[model samples]
Target: MTGTVTCEPGTPGVPGTVGTSGTPGAPGTPVVRRNRRATRPAPAGVDPRPSQHALTSRASEDRPEGWGDASASKQVSSYDAELQRDKPPHWG
Candidate 1:
């Protein structure tokens, strides 16, 4: 013969594996999903700059001046990785 074990639900405002009211999908209880991205910080020693995310950093400084979230503005539609490979470093 085989036997089965059942578990009871947890109290309100407290986290548990079972749903509210000792049943699954019960009312008056809401499932809260954590925002993993918002709570996480940038990896140690990893640059947070948008330019640092690029495959190549041509002449961009390790800590570029006036750096901000340039994700939308820094992108070049005419950028060619292969062509830029042979071009001389740009200096202004």
Candidate 2:
């Protein structure tokens, strides 16, 4: 004769089968509980401008005036004897 297996609470049994006296939906699905903090609005009369414009304007001002100018040449001389011998014609 074939016998059926029964499991009590806190005992090991087949997966998805809840033991007797255990809560419904206990074995199949997990219970999720979340603790969330309440968000508060910012205080009144505080200026938020420093964070917005501080980096952008300062970075633009810090750049040299010659950075994007085509006429400003970094090369001191085109015919330096040492550079002419070492470098290719296309690089000069």
TM-scores, all models, native as reference: 0.21, 0.22
- lDDT per residue, candidate 2, 20-60, as tens digits? 33552343334233455587665788654556655435344
lDDT of each candidate versus the true structure: 0.49, 0.48
Which candidate achieves the best TM-score against the true structure? 2
Lowest-sum lDDT 10-residue window in model 1: 1-10
Show the colliding residue pairs in model 1: none
Model 1 ranges with Cα > 4 A deviation: 1-26, 37-46, 51-92
How does candidate 1 fare on TM-score? 0.21
Best by lDDT: 1
Query: What is candidate 1's lDDT per residue for 41-91, written digit by digit as tens?
Result: 679897666565657644455444336334555664454555556686773
